[model samples]
Target: MTVNDGTATGTTHGSMADAELVSTEVLLAKPKRVVREDLKMPDGRVIDWYFMDTPDSVMVVPLTNDGRLVFVRQYRHNLKKHCIELPAGAVSAGEDPAEAALRELEEETGYRLAEGEELVSLGRFYSLPSETNKYTNFYFARVTWDHEPILDNEIEAYFDMSVVTIPAADVFSRLAGEINGMETAGALMLSQRYIAAA
Candidate 1:
């Protein structure tokens, strides 16, 4: 597909950065949405309404030549439960998704990638359309080490997401319910497309 620089309107074949939609109009405006606070059917009732615009984020599935996929199992105080998600976080001010993924990988997982193998951009994703305007970029990092992964301070204490691998053949099972996060799911979906093409 024909592509535009710094736009994601309809581009399908260019570098993702070229297609990464950064339209100020789309990014700047508050979400144009409404929530109804009161509902009257056969009986009159009231509830609540809220409007929100979610943040831009990133998700990663760090891989090593030895065939390990970095997975983080953390306690989500908000959800009040633990989920096995890949390392991830929101993109910071003026930060690129790929760069954020790399930094988050090191900060959360402490596994360094070899100098050359960097992120292969998967694509952009939207989360929770009902209330969020967030976009998450998926990334893959290749590690060169042959040992167990080390963990960062807060991550080590709050969550037990030590890097581990699910066999290539068992991905559908391991990552089935919630073994991965939203971005991880997106990345795996893209990777499946890559594998199918091969």
Candidate 2:
């Protein structure tokens, strides 16, 4: 599943290449990469401020034994507010997303899944792709588990999380508008599609 779907991607007010053009050199250098702040315009090509590198990220939507979801609530300083988010983590170099999700589910929420029920790939984030070539893969998985808190390998602080036992019908009531992340919203929409078809 993907957002904007290309047909609407280019037609929309935003550019569709999902790729940003960076045409600067030797501004600054970092440990794993360099900093290229000068970007070029498409036609004549100009110079602007844009970072040359960033880390890949990942997020997850997890379901537990009692048919409830496991989400995390944390104070996102960047947003200067708190958010309700699904269990998520980063995909380390050379790590399979399925394995990463499993490890992350426990590490972030302390729920070791018994087995994964279904896996859904939501495609790449191409976040500000027009600016960088970084495309991080995001995914969703429905899993069943008997949760017993494992303090040693869990988030240090818990903000607010509930095993939301809402029916599937209720999931989409908040889509296409006020839902948080696009990836989660998209994957849940895909989940609804798969659920309806079956």
Best by TM-score: 1
What TM-score, to 2 decimals, does candidate 2 have?
0.61
lDDT by residue (41-122, candidate 2, tens digit) is 4344455655546556666666544545556655665677665566666667788876777777766666664463656676
Instruction: Compute each candidate's TM-score over C-alphas.
Output: 0.63, 0.61
Query: What TM-score does model 1 achieve against the real structure?
Result: 0.63
User: What's the number of clashes in each of the models?
Assistant: 1, 9
For model 2, which pairs clash?
Answer: 19-129, 19-130, 20-129, 20-130, 20-131, 39-48, 40-46, 41-45, 41-46
**Candidate 2: stretches off by over 4 Å:** 1-34, 37-46, 116-118, 130-134, 146-167, 176-178, 194-198
lDDT of 1 by residue, 13-63 (tens): 433223322222233343233333332322223333343455678887666
Q: Any residue pairs clashing in model 1, and if so which?
A: 73-161
Which ten contiguous residues of candidate 2 have the minimum total lDDT? Answer: 8-17
